[model samples]
Target: MAREGQESPLLKVEGLAISHGDVPITLPLEIVVERGETIAIVGESGSGKSLTARAIVGILPPGINAKGAVTLDGVPLMRLAERELRTIRGSRVSMLMQDPFTMLNPLMRSGDHIDEMLRDRPEFASRAVRADEVKRRLAEVGIVDEDVARRMPFQLSGGMCQRVALAAALARDPELLIADEPSTALDVTTQAEIIKLLRRIQRERNMAVILITHNLRLAFSTCQRIYVLYAGSMLEVGDAAAVERQPFHPYTLGLLLSEPPVDIRVPRLVAIRGSVPRAADVIDSCGFADRCEWAKQICRAGKPSLAARDASRFTACIRQDEIQGELDALRSATLSATPETPRRGGTAGALVHVDALVKTFAGRRGRPICAIRDVSLHIMAGESVGLVGESGSGKTTIGRCLVGLETPTDGDIRINGIAAADFGAMAKADRDRVRRTIQMIFQDPYSTLNPKHSVGQALREALGASAGAPSPAPQERIASLLAEVGLSAAYATRRPASLSGGERQRVAIARALAVKPAILVCDEPVSALDVSVQAQVLNLFRRLQVEHELSYLFITHDLAVVRQIAERIYVLYLGEIVEEGPTERVISNPQHPYTRRLIESIVRSAIQRAP
Candidate 1:
């Protein structure tokens, strides 16, 4: 399918299928990557994005098998032996995983990791030369700190660890790089820097790249082409700009609409209804039929084929043309709609107050590291206050201090007119009374919930520990709590591992609500979720706020998400509050330089995608 005078693709995937044991996980798929080109494979979690990448690299777990043809530079990889594949893995094609901290060896130094990759190469004839190359590679990835070479993985920051990982991946100067969710763990500013560095390296080396991610907007910003996948099937493929401007498949359009725009604020984000179907449940029909609003009976009659819409576009939907028209109308209606005016709250006295709060930790060689300075803030009853900052900016530290996870070094914290310091000194009943009034929801809900307990058991345990007077039976109360978070009572029988990311978060919220807390401290609750799932959770938060009249301390690095949920915003940098004001005012006219820099890193592709 090459044009005249064009070279064959650097990588070609034809009729590629993956299976575990006897059950097939992915259908036959095709992908092509030209030399020096960047393409994106985008979808939500469990869409086979990661599995496909693993299959291509011959790294699937035991019992999983990959079939069909995959070629790099006209060399077939399907029939290659394990020893042969090892020879081609790092020298010709390299991969970077999602979490660098976990991927890297904690015992080894940063420079040592890269040195090991180059140890087998003949180009570096001496240790001195290899040492110099290690520094050069680190500098190539924007890590200029010479001391990073000697420090362990835990000693480095998240950004620095990721840069080291990138340096190691490029040790052999591979022809192709596979970066899987590269920036999902870093803050906004660090993510932008990493992506910029990646593009620069790809261009300098003329290497091809396959970016796999759950974020469509992120993929569009860095890639020339995008392939949208859903329920283990490829749904759409097109030029990045073409897909952004006019996505053909209903699922693709839904993904585009789910993204929260940084340039403008909306009353509610457009969410795709329903969760992705489980792999076992996917039938020989449209994978998105359950969630597609315009689906007809024909959609479920048989599986649709990927048909060409134009020279550069293909979609797996029989109703693409019809759905495109409906999408255009919806965009028009959204553009013409009046913006909703948000109500300002916090007229009552402060329900939670911290004065001269300070927290410090022991650093290397016993030096003191101040996590938070003499920072002070308050939240009034029934108000949502956002705490915005980068990873090491002390946002999580403050949240922990507020919820009794960590005792403050120096400060005064009062909850509902009671001194937080007196909690330990008070009677067990009194301490429970004050603690039950406030609850904290962590970033990973699965980690917080006990995996062995069913959802009903978890909720029952929480209800049993309540200090307040009980009025309902345990089962009845559990059902009510689940329903409050938009979940059915049947979910109570399922364990945490059986639920999706969004579903687990909903269960976590229900558990937090079991004690009838007046305030909730949510810490980056939706950062790792898909856009559609994130919107659903955000909407659930809004509804819960109104129904329970609960105050919220929403902490996140995403400005768009904060603007949607928080009434007032506090921008934190280096353990200090740089700016604080109404969400609109602060985001529109940031006074602090740090706040402005944070805003600049936000990707505004959602607004730019439309006219």
Candidate 2:
């Protein structure tokens, strides 16, 4: 326990409930954070992690009702008026959102956003002083150049934009800092740097931080205490290390088992079965009972309150003892298994092949930046090949080059024995045919689907523009496409704004499939989605590929996703392919130093519980 001081226990919450349009999305929740302490809220998507944070900040979306006691130094946030809440927003508690691009004003320069946060501060009254402070903050977050700070949000990379946002949020030095999946949008290296920066900031300022995320490893690595939420209810809470070492709840145990082990190669991931229950569903029983292997009749009868499983750990599951034993046996078995090398085997026929691929871009001072260098690989006609790397490792660039968005400076790209250069030199009609064979599904579905158009309209435009010859009626095809992506035909009339994050992604996938392409370029497709939704999407991708014989060039930074679908894996580093082998082998053995580092980092994260 942390020692109490005048400014200790910066924030505390009790029985927080949030509803959307009369539907309760989250159940009663509770959390606490002391000055200079980090509290991590961990759960799968739809687990109500983000909603809990929003409730604390008094920023629940329209039509959402929040009932709770949120206190900051004994001041009741729920009782405060909107006008009063605004004054405390940045000055007392500030938030760094998941996507910096969305949080920032696109029309304004990066420096301006930081300056705006510090506008009322007496020390920043002078323009020159403000500029210097902004630059210093930028530099502290790994952006070393003044020119980079002057650019607009759109002009900067995702990592750079996030750094600028962090600088802006820290400008006020608020008493409480709420970081909602701050590193989700960044690459692995950038994610590490951001975590380190947050730790330093917390230590230096003694600010209470509410870190909300689905990544258990990240939470264990950085937070002092861990609060596991499921269906908007607190499932468990304990010291980070203690809870991870001996997870008391079945949900927490499932989450721990689901994560790929560090030292040994497990045959298959132990995924929790079933999807997260919808917001409209009744929360009468344990939220995790449906998917729990050890669930008993009592678990389904009624919701369970958090009960002490030991001196320090509290769990809400009725079968915690039984599940704990099972989890222990599984962990021991996993740790004892001998690591095996990964092998590749799949469908026949080569769909795409790259030989000595190289891409270079001009840097700020006329220096050359090697984006992809001497990369070689092959993807079968009906296989899903994963490309994994930290940020700036050329994963996105490779995807871009394959989709013809960027012409590679040097390399031979062959699609079905036809060279890309030869295809580029062919007639327009021939080029169009080749282009239709491959399509890309972007990371953010909302951005990919135009807000102005309905789902039906978007599909129609993509089909009409990309498909060579239209044989079927547009309406029928649109309906079929929606059904194929697990959406109802009635959704055709709705715009992207009306859909959930998962629904919008399904629409994006449907739009990509409108042309019936042979291959799909999925770039971080599930990174932005909730875990349960991610599972559904992954299953959908697999089903689609098997049913349609579709090939995939899957690019992502997440190794767990790669292990799920990818048979062969290519590990990139600073635009170079450092390792290439079967997914299991690369992850377990990890021949390359960078790959080893990544694995070690993940292991270290898992072992080091919060605080």
Candidate 3:
């Protein structure tokens, strides 16, 4: 069937707004999608992008009031009853939720998920036909093995779980698909594979897709049009090409420029200065005015109306015409922030060393699963080492074993010339000394922090574990620690639930530094943050390393971040070290095929992008 004329869009949203208990979650917004079009809704975290999506699909949480007009193929979604809306979900529209581990049921096998989705379909009522269709759908998403269908979500890797989620979504056979942060936790190569798979399926089925992600690169490269939102309001909407080349909204421009350019000349990154405002603040005036460099008094007084400049572009800035000059000047200036720091305490000998390390787990039927196999690496004092690999390659397991969370099955780990085995068996004083010497900054900050404790209490507890006489007043030291992490003393009283992801991570770092550790094992610290926040945290790491003379064992799946932070690189594959060398040499001329493919996969992900 041919697409309808532009007179009728496949999915149309007009004046959509959401509120919870008199607080605005999203301002009045408008969106339109033609048949077979893939549109991107891009913004930073807490910008209301996901809230808008939830409202569109009628899945908003309790107490949240959704006021909008949503139409799909001339059917009024907002007007539908609960029973009516539920019927249209899988057959008419399907949503591929973010974080498959949470979205999917852990108790059920992967095959059961597909079966549940297909159960509603008329063609697969028979058991044998449904079983065969399950395998077929899984193969379409790149999971070709039938054995994978029997495994529960907890048994599969992050990338494999994502493919299973995609396969389940496809089984619904909907006319429209909403992929919410589909590639968020995935590594670059795995992310690329998922993106490619989605695009291919979209084209093959000629289905309209709504891609909800904070990644600007994905917005520019994968979608036909982009809608930029800030604090619940639509700031800009335009064709991806025009918007990427010359964005009218200041927030949009800032988001694009915040990404570190691959060019050597642009060594520093200019981060957006402020974070998103509170829900109450967003309801009164322009939510981004305080953060935008070009804001005027009028901008904060009242909200700016979205005005169309042409048939294909719209912007909400009242002074959109004046923003270009400011942006141009910002582009030409050398970055104001120092993104890199010189090696602070580089020593002749290694600070932490591993020799023939191995970690194995007992699998089903008592089979041994080797997570780490004879991996040996070292980091010098004040030097940063990158441990890069796909999921299940043991990058995190190494960090755990080095930190003594896991006992090494074989080989040795030496921290400051003390063997891990000896350290574990040492006297109480010696163990305390080792704990102070080496500490870990976990990947998820909230999980590491206690919900019952305030930030001040957390810091104070670190001080209480003192290796010396207590300071005169712990409050002064707590304030100092907060300041060192770029947070104010006010943050000390705030609990973990009140802080943002970036703020929580900073607190995690401050707590680690409170013990004055000689070395920090940072495990994907910035992976959970937004792009702008990620830059800020990375810059903070460099500055702290210089100030405290610290060494870091940085484990991450993002090769780009590893390239920026690590001096040396180790590429792991299937629990074995496949490649190891200086960061530059390893990235440019990788020796192993796995390393080379990892590099190429990232490059190929940008198959289409705005110049």
Residue-level lDDT tens digits of model 3 in 395-485 = 9999988888888889888888777744567678767877888999998999999999999999999998868765658899999999999
Q: What residue runs in model 1 are displaced by over 4 Å at the alpha carbon?
A: 1-5, 335-337, 426-430, 606-611
| Candidate lDDT (C-alpha), each | 0.88, 0.81, 0.83
Give model 3 RMSD, 1 decimal.
Answer: 2.9
Q: What clash count goes with each model?
A: 0, 5, 0
The CA-based lDDT of model 1 is what? 0.88
Clashing pairs in 2: 223-610, 223-611, 224-611, 240-610, 342-585
The most accurate candidate by lDDT is: 1
The positional error of residue 173 in candidate 1, measured at the CA in angstroms, is 0.6
Error at 196, model 1, angstroms: 0.6
Q: Residue-wise lDDT of candidate 2 within 1-611, one digit each (tens)?
A: 22334454678788888888678888877777887789899988778888788889899888889997999888899999999998889888999999899889999999899889888989889999998988888887778988987798988888888889988888887889999999987876678778888888788888889899888778888887999988778889888988878777777766766654444444455566666776457478887777877878888898898887666678887777766788777666655555443344356667888889998999878999889999998998777799989877899999988877888889888776667744567678657766788889989999888899999999999888775674678899899999999898999999999887888888999998888888899999988876556766877887788777788889988776777677788988888888988777788788888887766544344532222
After TM-score superposition, the amount by which residue 386's alpha carbon in candidate 1 deviates from its true location, in angstroms, is 0.3
Model 2 lowest lDDT segment of ten: 602-611
